[model samples]
Target: MELKTIEELNQIGFEKIGEWKINKRGALDYEITTDKTTEVLYSFVKVDNQKEEIIYIGKTIRTIINRLNGYKKPGNSQFTNIRINKEILNLLKSDLNVNIYLFKCNDVITYKSHNINLAAGLEDTLIKYFKPKYNLHGNQRIIDDVELSENLIKLTNDMNDDKNCQNHYLIEKTTTVSNLEGKINLGNVPFSFLPEYGEIINIYLGDIVLQANFINGNNNGGNNPRINCVAIGNWLRENGINVNDNFYIKICNNNSFYFSINKIY
Candidate 1:
């Protein structure tokens, strides 16, 4: 399938049904009143002045209102809804602008002897072609990169085998709210990955270094050790490192570590 831009989708049949934004009470609200029962292929787009980019694309047989409500107050079992909700909230918190667009497909076509719902069929095509970041399919490539963590573990072991080696590495996936807030759980990392608790360490994000205190989670009843570096969180957000992206840390010594990001494409 070929990639289609929002403009191309608009030319094909998509419509600007309305916009969506967090309301005063922190709930998602669409600007124009819409039919609660209309099934649709909807998209979330980020707008910056005249520039627009599609971030997510989805189709639902469920009522449009019901679909949006799924994002507003996602159920525990609704993983997609939950992820999208967190992403949208994060974007809004950063003071970025987002809008929603919709398309209703009425045309039915037969494949072989079976009729296909155009919206349903088009959903996969759009996702595969456009690759909206918030959609699961859009993140498949980055998710596959998690294999890099396994390889990195092996490398760290190789380095640790050397009696004189003090350097180690940790490859972690950014999957928690704490990660975005400048705290990283070191529970899964080896004890040697960081210095002794209460010691100060320099965290390097490129050339920028932030000295931070270390708290060994083990000493605190097995609580995960953390690096509370607000600057790293701000850097991640500013650099568009959303949740689920993989990042690596190079522990150069007992007193310092550096970061490298594998951003989502």
Candidate 2:
């Protein structure tokens, strides 16, 4: 027999039609009068406004349907009726407004045998090919990649022991001059040290270093200690420096200061 039209079948509410055939395995094999069973497998709802989207694809199987709805308490069944039930429920709740298409079969093979096996094989192939979002097994490769990136970031962060040290110092002051002159700039410092200083100081000092000029401020003078404590504090926090570490800021000139981060790691 020829396969029934999709529109016609949907109008009849898939359950009332009883014309089907049973194969040797007691599985239902609907005889398609017009198209082959493979064609019916190709028909599926395109999801997410995709021109080539194929959400769900499967051949009509009487045994599969009977097994799904046969028992009021299907929880004890060997087959994965629970998963199948969820899949159907998800489809009904989907925002894409997808419709299910039923193909009437004229043959019924023995249950759990060749016909059922063929239907299952076809289902697996379709699941792999289209990768429906609702299907849990579908799109596994992409999901694995996403999961891997998250794991890597978590692992790297976990390796850092002193990640929350707030009062860390970045620049160590080791030298002092009675009469110091010229520009001081911290921008020439290594990129690794840039994180030690808060983002603002890093930007300012980095710019100064790049220009080869030091920021000569009133904080360091001939009589007073020539250390930019504010800049050092910013650097410490940025680099995860701890307050317990003793360090000093070395003034390179009026425009820049050398930041030394105390190692607590």
The top-ranked prediction according to TM-score is 1
Q: List lDDT for all candidates, in order.
A: 0.61, 0.32
Off by more than 4 A, model 2: 1-53, 58-79, 90-96, 103-121, 136-265
The digit string of per-residue lDDT tens for model 2 on 127-201 reads 565576554434553211111111111122221123332223345422222112211234434322222111112
Over 4 Å off, model 1: 1-4, 36-39, 139-265
Candidate RMSDs in Å, in order, are: 18.3, 27.1
lDDT of 2 at 46: 35
RMSD of 1: 18.3
Model 1, position 150, has a per-residue lDDT of: 10
